[model samples]
Target chain A: MRDEAVLRHSNIWRPETIEDIQTKAELGRYRIRGFSALRSRVLPSFDDLTFIPCTLTRVPLEGYREKCSTKTVLGTRFAKKPLELDIPIMVTGMSYGALSYNAKVALARAATQAGTSTTTGDGGMLMAERENSRVLIYEVLPSRYGMNVHHLRMANAIELTVGQGAKPGTGGLLLESKVSDEIAAMRDLPAGVDQRSPCRHPDWLGPDDMILKIEELREATDWQVPIFVKMGASRVYDDVTLAAKAGADVVVVDGMEGGTGASPDLLMDHTGIPTLAAVCEARAALEDMGLYGEVQLIIAGGIRSGPDAAKALALGADAVYVGTAALIALNCNKPIYVEDYHKLGTEPYACHHCHTGRCPVGITTQDPELVKRLDIDEGAERVVNFFHAMTLEIQMLARACGKADVHDLEPEDLRALTLEASMITGLPLVGTNVVFAGGPGWKKSTHR
Target chain B: MVRQVECTGKTTREINQEIRRLIGDGEQEIVVLRPQARHNLGVAVLQPVKLVFEGSVGYYCAGMADGPSVEIRGSAGWGVAEGMMSGTVIIEQNAGNSAAASIRGGTVVVRGSASARAGIAMKGGTLIIQGNCGYMTGFMMQKGTIIVCGDAGEALGDSMYEGRIFVGGSIAEFGNDAVIQELTPEDREFLTSTLTQYGITSARPFQKVVAGRRLWRFDKKEFATWREAL
Candidate 1:
């Protein structure tokens, strides 16, 4: 007790996390999303489910050596040069102030090793991460950080964010409880106070101005980078049509289940269209505009595995982006952090506290000490491993489908369960082509 | 990287001619806004350039630059780098609104504060504000990131689709289709790196602001969940 008496007098934890946090359902909180909702609510019923059972005419993709290749090209619609990757999985954009530098580094390094690309979120570009990742997708958002000419010149592609699926129209908040001294400095904001970011752009008032803006970027960067526009699924047809017309090389649509830095529980469970529905609308929009196949479509939000990806592709997505699943691969719920998760009033599986950078496991903090918990090399390797696993799974699915390449999995290969899906996606059902029209045995949604 | 340049000078025709010549001669990188840069009333346009402005710049400095990275040494007049796409523009000093109006891709960083409507209707790209900003920043932005280090005026990020707004200081107000949520692991991880990358190691504990999910429209069950909570 004599030796421990002195140590007991003071706590070593950062002072910011202990105090300064009041209420977080707050409209005045800092920017970003990814938090657990304090209050419980009636969860949305996504109970509509169906199964793709095996039959005499249907066979499953071989899992191991089916010669299934998972490879695809993106952004050739407008850019003279497009990006090529060795694997199917790519890192999605998360932000600075919402994540730690080490996290970014891991993503960059992981993407590099996996031979895929990593995206920069709303927060400015981090040099350490950039140097590691050979291909980087820079995000142009409503809230710009560390933005400049130098970085743009280095970018492979630029994604213009309109909304995300998690909490589509909602602006996110990062609480001061997670704010480390270092994070505060880069952002140039006061320490320990809730920050607010307006949800709108102040420059132009309409689509016409957007056209000019796109022109300016082309002029400035010599048109080296492909400019893709991203939007939350709202008026899917209208939004994608506008984006294509606005000169986007690619259109990314995030479904309702998309992750966030920290969104209201109410919003995440409530907002936006599902990935399947949105894909249909977006596909229709591009087809009508004669830009389909020419303009690539990337779907994100709740994609988990190779099968999910195949399903999305069958529904018409060129590629599917996975965020939460990637985090899981990065050790999001390793059970080792069970105690830490409890400290945040959540569980390991509920590790969505992006609002507060003060993740107990050291994945998202500016504090040098806390950040040390993250072994960058090990983390990067984990990400690479995850990518490899996913690629293998995609290959398995493709081979089972009797295809040599994952890209060969097209919409025509899918069989919808409900008539609504057949009508929306134009795919035939498992054993019958009469999904929406006529078939021997079929079921239609009563709502339709 | 392909580069382009446009000179904003009295002779609009001359500036255009020079830019075209530079491109023709295989000069992929160009800088139009140099320190102490001066120009007459002329409309200039550029494709892309790793351009720099060492000194103060004049009006319409980067009126229609596309896919070029332009840095301005001094403050700019009205409509500086208006309608830029796929390139980056950094201003050492304050800027007029519409600095990155309708920006499709790339980013714009202002070391000093920005006037009103800095990123109006920005479709893509990012706008960084090291200093304070006037009202109506990020108004109707279809997508992109806009970060203000200093205090922001009213109605920021109004009706934004995607992208995010991170600020260190107090926000005067929150805009339409926008609310505040908590930050997650990825967000904190990003903040640590973002601060270190740009010598912004000074500000700790930044807040992340994102667009409200309601804009994408809602389903009946989803709508009920949101309503019941409130």
Candidate 2:
């Protein structure tokens, strides 16, 4: 036999791939997991672009001293009352079933304290969540589980969800381990059974029908709150345009990197467009229809820090929604419970066992024992600190770019670090004046 | 008191606002004229009142309403009383697709034939169709009662969780996990009372359809059943 160090691994048929095949062979089904994708290949992300602060051309405000407005207003088109947030960052929708009761309340409390908005997810509004939140966005998902008219009336905004990023064109999945008695009762499902939600809304189908559906929702709320049409970032240009045309006050595009509580590993690894590319397409779509500013755009998926949020805003987004990051702030994968994490067959930072309902730090599990580990007030404080830090980082970048308001940070303030980023965003690469490929404006020019 | 509103030049917004204002101002009965099949009329009317639509109405007429009794003299478009919590909707003529979709509780009576997917995803309510019904009737129905007086098209009661479907005409084909059950005296009594309340009569003996519960939980041994259900 040759020396062990001299042995070369096959690039095509890798060790991990072999293990995956064997696992599936034994299970006789696709593997299920939680969290975002674990793709090994590098995708174009916000990190590919860097902000160009004022050097000699533009005047820079003092980063620490100057006041930069983080105020974000969404849904100026047709809503009587739009969402007014203190910061451009918001807590994305995560269902009560996907997260524990303690986790939901903590997020709501933190959002209220931070003066931002929090959204309800697939399982409908938790009464405690509503009570804890100052500004609540009600989601009208395909499942329609626990949907109530009284709850609809009580919401500040309504989000008509078409799809999500992690698993587009499919319904939500909650594995048997996470489907507790309370969750089952709320969702009208049997306890301890894997819950697969419906992909299509029972009432409507296509965009034309969606127009009527929007009208119905508007009528339901007495046209008092904004109606947001949220979809996974596939066919972003067409989908965004249709959503805007169908009378959406706000359009949310969730990219492929978005997180989920439980999903097929295959779907998590492969589906939808990247958030960076998605924002460009969405902005272009809105601009093509001459409704860019009229209909607000919110971006979600893989937005980790202030730099990412700033880059997204510079690209075109009015606001950014964070899901996994918020959960992280609530101690989702903390290393405190070393033994518990080991028992789940994962390490502290490498844990993606949320689908198993055995979360060590207790943000995503329904088990009472795990849930008790997360103190609601302490978790809320931690998340509030994270939100503050993110908001400060965003403000610092905006001030450095000579923007008085975070929303004023435009694409001109950004420069691509790579050729792929330059091509995707239509931005000039650093130290280069050439635009390598067609960008957001390419579609408009072709149509003309 | 009775109030009449005209839909000649006013927008759907203006019309709905006026209807709500009238309801707020202690009007027990409101009649809408020349609806022109406009969509989203009398939606979200939580007050207990009576609404009379003189002509045909477009999509989602009386949608998301909690408490109201609406009478459409002409035909109705899709989702006639969708998401209604508790109410009564009576359509005089034919209804378009997905009529009474996803209603939690209420009574929807379609006097004439109804199009496809009627009573789809109904949570809890009673849907009475006097004439024929199109395909996929009661599809994914959770908890409700659908009474069809005439022929039922293909794929009836598909993937339903828990519901009762009584068809008075020839069976087309059952959908996945949907099974026919021998009707009991209690089911017959409920159907008779519901149909009679809606002024509907049928000559043919009704066949009851319900969920087989096979799709409720996944079983590895029942691969064929799971394959179709999934």
Best by DockQ: 2
TM-score of each: 0.66, 0.95
Per-residue CA lDDT of model 2 for A129-209, tens digit only, reads: 999999999999988877888899899999999999999898998877788999977776567767788888877899999
Separately for all candidates shown, the number of backbone clashes (residues 3 or more apart, or on different chains) is 144, 0
lDDT string for model 2 (B115-220, tens) is 9999988888889999999999998887889999899999999988888899999868898888999999999889878887877777689999999988775565
- What lDDT would each prediction earn against the true structure? 0.65, 0.89
Tell me the deviation in Å of residue A164 in model 1: 1.8
Please tell me what DockQ candidate 2 reaches: 0.38
What TM-score quantifies how close candidate 2 is to the native fold?
Answer: 0.95
Docking tier of model 1: it is incorrect
Interface RMSD (Å) of candidate 2: 6.0
Top TM-score hit: 2
